[model samples]
Target: MRRLVARDERWPLREAFVIARGAKRQAHVVVVEITDGVHHAHGEAVPYARYGEDVPGVLAQIDALRPAIEAGADREALLRLAPPGAARNAIDCALWDLEAKQAGVRAWDLVGRPPPSPVKTCYTLSRAAPAAMAKAATANARRPMLKLKIAGADDLAAVEAVRAAAPRTRLIVDANESLSFEDLQRLAPELVRLDVQMLEQPLPVGEDAVLQGYESPIPLGADESLHTRADLEACAARYTCVNVKLDKAGGLTEALALAQDVRARGLDLMVGCMVGTSLAMAPAMMLTPGARFVDLDGPLLLARDREPGLSILGSMIEPPPAGLWG
Candidate 1:
């Protein structure tokens, strides 16, 4: 019989991670482990309040599914057993890790993908005043790319400050569903002129219809607005790109499928992550092969990461070793 274990953990951030939504000083994550007497594997996920999930609720959800999981429920079985959220994400990824260990092969082999390669990731600067943002941008100016978290007001000044501080660094901005249609319209032209490469989730989630016929100079990528394949059709009509995160898609199983659908629709792909540990970012690395932007900088923001984490060299993230999860 298989054994299942799930628990909540908190990892402190190097500094507060502020976004348009709010700020967090720690990442609250739920980790799941499955073992079949001889072999064991693990998975991790961050419970996002925006998705109506909290650590206690996620832990309870996982506990409720313990019976089925220990009885050998596979990844496909999990889709019907649990709704998409942080709970299913932890369980599904643990199953993948367990399967990879049992077979003595990498998880990519099971998914029929080539071995993952080191990918360049964007360093993120939290929402702050223009001067504060400029200071942070100056510190990371040598990074290949920097993603700025912006709120509607004073955002132009913040981006302009960042651009001036890091003239050679590529820039992308995320509004975290905090912007209105008018805010996007007013900011798009200036962002383009500042050489900003992309703008993510400017409008609120359900209100994405506001972008139906509108065209902007900078490409808009859907983050909070797009989750799994079910959300693709509506988002494709409104946005030029999609951000795929394992926790948002439920797990790697669904994220891989969503990545393909994003490409099939001719929308650019960006694999992103919540502010968790490297364990949470490891599985997401699988989706970065052809992605236009990779934002799996979860560990970089942490004060300390789980040992045996993915190797990050400067702005590049190396693939996770089997010991870490696959």
Candidate 2:
């Protein structure tokens, strides 16, 4: 019989990660390992509080499915066994890794995708005062792209400051469900003037209907408003792009399908990640081949990353080695 193992780990951040929701000093993650005596594989995910997931709760969820997983429930069966969330994400990715090792082939090969090339990821500037944000932007000025976390108030000032600091850096502003329709309308023109290429989740989830007929100067991406394929139809009508995260989509199994569906529907794709370690970001690289944006900078924000992590050269992230995760 196959054996399954699950545990929680905490990795401290280099500095506090502040977003519209709040601040976090460390990443709390759930890790899963699956082995069949001879071969082993691992996966990791972060339990997001916004999704009502805590480390203890996610651990419990994984433990509840231990029997089924060890009983030979494949990735397809996992979809029915657990709802989309951090718990299922860890298990699903672990199974994918296990399969890759068992077959002696790379995970991307099994998925029928080319090997992931080194993709340049956007360095994130956490929510801060305009001056502070500018300082952070200046520090990362050499990076090709920068994503700023913004709230409703003084957002324009912050973006302007960042633009002035890093004039050539492509910018993406994420409101994290903090903005209203009026806020987006008021800021879109100013953001465009500041050369901001995209705005993410500016409006709250249920309020996206207001954008159906609105014209935006900058392309808008759906994050909290779009989780999986189930949310495609509604989100496609309102947003120009969708940000896919493995944890939000449950795992690579669903994430790959979601990424393809997003592209097929003519929406831009952005592969994003929560504040976690390299193991969490490793599986997400599989979706970056044709992505319009890649935000797998989680490990960059951490004080220290797990060993056998993906090699990050400057802002470019290399794919995971077989020794890591798929």
Candidate 3:
């Protein structure tokens, strides 16, 4: 006797969110709410087209699990039930929420993690021409850290623009797997000169095998190329860090494990989020303490966020409010 509710939601972004891949004006997400009659909890997931996930496909995956979930299947059962992706992420988080409500405890406590404290988050400068990107960077100039999306060689001018606008702000350039080794090498000097703290996923996953012996001036991080704990071994040798998004690792359960594995291998951890609501960012906050960088600014990009959202005072994300899912 559990109840499961699943649906799709669309939150309009304040403006088009541009990445190396493309542009999006809205965040399309799948939401799940599970209840044990007396108490309930929610989870949210963005059906990333990059992962070949669409709203219908993700919902169908959850529908397939309804019988088992209603029969009291736990989060571990979900890992085997659904392949790791947006679908699994939504359900896994929902289960965590439900369990927390049932035990009358916080989600972090249920997961055996420390309660979150406010952390500095990366404000993203979407992919744009140098001037536009620079203007955006200047607008967020006060932010402690900024993540610049690099689409190609033209982004050199964009980086220069941002640097000119915000001289003191720390920078992380996420190429989103758009650069070849030569492209990466050509930009390395400029990136270091700009004092860019991190270079993220400049090369595509399959093609990144060349990174093993490359001498990179700036520390590089993996986003698209790193997934579960399984990716830690190979990525540790190639990347100095890995960006852990709950969508990629399936949920908080796997993300915690991935973070532990990344640390065990001496790789830096970055907790990132796809554009969604605060519900998505709240669980990710659990990983923030150990992360080298935090990119949980999804709600800030949206035109409107759900009530009881995580408070954002400037670029810092505070812990989740009680009314919001843990």
The local distance difference test score of model 2 is 0.93
Give the lDDT of residue 318 in candidate 1. 94
lDDT of 3 by residue, 86-190 (tens): 989999989988888888889888857778989989999899988898889889999999999988866899999999999999999999999989999999889
For model 3, the stretches where C-alpha displacement exceeds 4 angstroms are none
User: In model 1, what lDDT does residue 155 have?
Assistant: 83
| TM-score, candidate number 2 | 0.99
- Quick one: how many clashes does candidate 3 have? 0
| Candidate 2 deviant stretches above 4 angstroms | none
Model 2 lDDT per residue over 276-315, tens place: 9999999999999899999999999999999989899999
* lDDT (Cα, tens digit) per residue for candidate 1, span 116-175: 999999999999999999999999999999999998845899999999999999999999
Residue pairs with clashing backbones, model 2: none
Q: TM-score for each prediction? A: 0.99, 0.99, 0.98
Q: Cα lDDT of all candidates, in order?
A: 0.93, 0.93, 0.91
Which 10-residue span in candidate 3 carries the lowest summed lDDT?
A: 317-326
Error of 1 at 163 (Å): 0.3
